[model samples]
Target: MEDNVKELIEITALVIEVIGILVLVFGTFLAMGRYAFKLQGEDIRSFQKIREEIGRSILLGLEILIAADIIATVVYDAQMEQILKLGLIILIRTFLSFTLEIEIEGKLPWKQEKHRTTGKK
Candidate 1:
């Protein structure tokens, strides 16, 4: 039973890792396709939009990869070492995500300005 559970967790982690890669690949392709097809005269704006979309996909993919890393850590023999390594991995990935978010949105996540919706009749 214990071995079975461990095997299941390892498999789950592998699946999650694959999903993360797929998300990054497909998201990037979709973003580039959209930019190619929906060309606008505003060159800078279009380029920036594609960049932001790609960055967003990277952020999400990193988050998913982090989750897979955590899941994979569960089966490691050296619990303490694995936990420390996982912590470092999470920290680095989190920093990357935050930086990508700032690059995409031009601000920190907490400092985002809420758009007030006006009630138009």
Candidate 2:
């Protein structure tokens, strides 16, 4: 019974991973197509839109990965192992989401160009 549960979890994890990879690849192609078709003055705006779409897609992938982690942890039902696995997944997904948010925004939240020009730390 337990072995069967583990096998199911492993299969679910594999499927989730494959779907996430496909999402990333498809998102990349969509962004590339958007950039390739847009012309001069509109290119920047179009690309920015593409970037936002890509970020959203990546976020969705991250969400699926998180779900898979949770499912695997539940299957294990071992306290220490489940905690560690879930913690790691949460940490990684949080960082990925943060990065995607910044990329979607087109700049660091509090970073200023003036700071760069003056070389102040």
Candidate 3:
């Protein structure tokens, strides 16, 4: 019964992970449409800011999915290999989240306003 319960939990986690992946994919489409359709403003700087925010949201969703995946793997197989893989996934996801957070929050180390005005300088 204990093993059965663990299996069930792993299955649930896998389902949640798959759902997260779908959400991430949909968010990507929304972000892409925002830029491709020019749904925002005539000002490129404003559009760029909107684009960055959308990208960050998508990244956040991906991070959630990665966490779900790691949990599912560990639940299914509590082996050293699975643990290592989970650690690597979490590390990469953390870095992505941190980098995107900095950009979306406009807390970049360098003066980003000038770069936005000058276009990727």
Top-lDDT structure, candidate number: 1
- What is candidate 2's lDDT per residue for 3-113, written digit by digit as tens? 887898888987887887788788777777766876324546775777787788898778777777766665666689768867987799978987886877767756644
| Per-residue lDDT of model 3, residues 44-68, tens digit only | 6756756675766667687777768
Error of 3 at 37 (Å): 3.3
Better of 2 and 3 by lDDT: 2
Clashes of each: 0, 0, 0
Candidate 1 segments exceeding 4 Å error: 39-44, 115-121
TM for candidate 3 is 0.68
lDDT of each: 0.88, 0.76, 0.73
For 1-121, candidate 1 gives per-residue lDDT tens digits of 9999999999999999999999899989989998999753465688888998899899999999999998998888887877897889989999999999999889878886666785422
Per-residue lDDT of 5 in model 3: 81
Candidate 1 vs candidate 2: the lDDT winner is 1
Clashing pairs in model 1?
none
Q: Kindly report which residue stretches of model 3 are placed more than 4 angstroms away from their true locations once superposed.
A: 41-47, 73-78, 108-121
Q: After superposition, how far is residue 61 of candidate 2 from its true place, in Å?
A: 1.1
RMSD of each: 3.5, 8.2, 7.1
User: CA shift at 117, candidate 3, in angstroms?
Assistant: 30
TM-score of each: 0.83, 0.66, 0.68
